[model samples]
Target: MFFQTEFTHVIELFQLPFMQRALLGGILTGIMGGVLGSFTILRQLSFFCDALGHSALLGISLGYLLGLNPSLVLLPFAVIFALAVSYLLEHTRLWTDALLNIIYSSSLAIAIIILSFVGQYKGGLNNLLFGDILAVQQLDLVLSSLLLIVCTIYIGMTLRTQMLLTVDESLAIARGVSVSTQRTVFIVLLSLVVGISIKSIGVLLVSAFVVIPACAARLMSRTFTHYVLLSAGLGALSAVLGMVSSAWFNLPSGPSIVATQLAIFLTAMVIPRLRSVTHSPSTLPPQV
Candidate 1:
């Protein structure tokens, strides 16, 4: 009776307009994260995405300093930054990690300095750093939905080419793929995704969305397609479970979702091992 009551209460909670919006926003973000995250993991650009997330503050700060809307500048600024990083990496001999670190640290410092001068912010910094999915408005949902569609169409068209490039640059080049151009395009897309997601997932935890689900799916998938699909499915599942838990327990939504993904990753890790142990010849009853 207690379990049924709890379940019914949770169902009723979702009937609220705010909860519905949060659910839609989270699902959109999750799907985009999973789709782009598969490539992020494949190309070992997890840190790149993380850097973009943190560096988004610079864009937000710039908006405040210039008396413009942060939302207006955020995506464009992220894209430019990503392009610059890509250009430098291609043309320079700097180590990828070192270059990214330089940019990440410097961007954060600059943003802080600018914010200090900007006097007051409409939304507190914690909201930017931690995110509040329950605060999602209709505009946020519409933007997220549109971005998801764009991301899906782009990924669908370039899936094969991107996969080949990820597997082997030399092979990709041999097959007439424009390696540099594709890389640039992907980085730009990643920047946009990470930039937009920072509003809901927060800069600190956004990378988890792109990394954890893919990592979990990797453990159980035999094919690349399976990995991609499972990662997206897991992402959506985590978001829903986390949102539900957040409402029930009155917890922070972003961290709740990230925690849920972490739990799923741990489960994925254990399941394969459990299967292996169960199928071991030693565990079999005389080959039965």
Candidate 2:
């Protein structure tokens, strides 16, 4: 019995490398998602992020077919797409949602066509579609970590300006905030974060990394600072838990992580509802 137990323990230990990478990646992703997501949520740009997520599929396919590093390739594409979209939004006066549809839908269709043409390899599209944490190399981990650090510092330094712009863009412009440049900078930073997180979350669901925890935290917190921190913590926790559970249960890490995040979001939603039910209505009359 002792030998059997030892054997099982050894088997578990064998998966540690994968788990370690996933945990580390998840932590960095959480920080990125949390900080950038706060901006995303505040700017009401979650749909833009979702569109960018789809745009990443184009970059991924192009990278694979061309034999380049997907993230590096995707970085430029994301930046270009972001810039183009920003320019269109600012100059053309077209609705932002309409622009997003034009960008994402076209990119996605192109990606599907390109990827389908590539000959199959083991786990071929799965890596780009769902992510493969076990495949993360030391270089990938280092790159992701560095990007996360940069994003954290950049966002931290500029958060006040971002907040001002988010609340009232015209007022921020009136106060000499350079709203256009700041908005441009913000989009670029978001692209970098999304580019870095693609290896772990994949092109398909990466926006969830930006949107889910932020939404969940919005339900639970009122202050911006608290909301950002809570969202980051929740994002990291969900990533770690999802990765571990996926490994243990032989599930897909990407979907599992997203599922866990959604569960947290649901819980947050329910708690407020439950509290509202249990607490009695105020006896005082409505404010005049």
Candidate 3:
């Protein structure tokens, strides 16, 4: 009994190379997801991120068909598709939502077709769609790290402009913010985050990383900067905990991490309401 219990505990983590990689990948993924997700939620672009994720599936298929690296091929493709979508939305009379749906559905179908043709490999589609964080390579790790640094620095330096644009684009333009240029930059950065996270979170659940933590932060933070920071922190915590838990239970890391995030989101949603009820209105100062 003692040996069995010990073995179970040991297998959960601190025993496998794949487990380490998954944990590291999750941390990086969370950072990037949290940073981009704040803008994603604030700008009402969660749908856009989902579209980008689906569109990236096309790139993944092309990679498998051509025997190239999926991450490399998917990165440029995601950026291109995101740019195309954003451009079409702004420059043409097309309905942005409809256009996004078209791109999303088409890309996903194409990927499924291509994957069917590719047939079997060791956990191919499973890794792409649901993710196998334990199988993350050094190349993918390096790529994610670089993208995370670039995004953090870029967004930090342009915080004011991003916040302004998120709240009211026309007003931001009136205040001398270049709407067109800023919008383009924002879309490109967002796409990069999605691309980088593809391996860690997979196509199906990547948007959860972007949406859940930001929603949690919304409950906890009052200022924009604090909200971003809080979201990032939550993301990191979830990544670490999920990775460890997955390894221990021999579960899928991507889903485990996302489950952790969902738990946080639920807690955030509930706590505020509970506080409102428990706190006394009579003791609190009256609102202006």
Clashes per candidate, residues 3 or more apart or on different chains:
0, 0, 1
lDDT of 2 by residue, 1-288 (tens): 976766576458446887677778877787689778977987889989988888888887888789886767988988888888778777887888998899889998999888877765324676777666556677778987888778778777887777788889888988899977888888998887777778788877889989999999989998987887888888888887777667666788788889989999999999999998789788789998
Cα lDDT tens digits for candidate 1, 1-288:
987888888899899999999888888889889988988998899998888889998998999999999988999999998898888877889899899899889998898888888879744788878777888889888888888888888878888887898888999999999987888777887888888888898878989999999999999899988888888888889999999898778789999999999999999999999999888777546855
Let me know the TM-score candidate 3 reaches against the reference structure.
0.90
- Residue 135 shift from truth in candidate 1, angstroms: 1.9
Clashes in model 1: which pairs?
none
* lDDT for each residue of candidate 3 in 9-93, tens digit (9 for 90 to 100): 8565655676677678889889888988998898889989998987788898888889997777888888888988887777878
Write down the worst ten-residue block by lDDT for model 3: 119-128
Q: Candidate 1, which ten residues in sequence have the lowest lDDT sum?
A: 279-288
TM-score for all predictions?
0.94, 0.88, 0.90
In terms of TM-score, the best-performing candidate is 1
Give the poorly placed runs of model 3, Cα more than 4 Å off.
Answer: 1-12, 120-123, 281-288
Off by over 4 Å in 1: 283-288
Clash pairs (backbone) in predicted model 2: none
Local distance difference test values of all predictions, in order? 0.88, 0.81, 0.84
Off by over 4 Å in 2: 1-15, 120-123, 281-288
Using lDDT as the yardstick, the better of models 1 and 3 is 1
lDDT, candidate 3, equals: 0.84
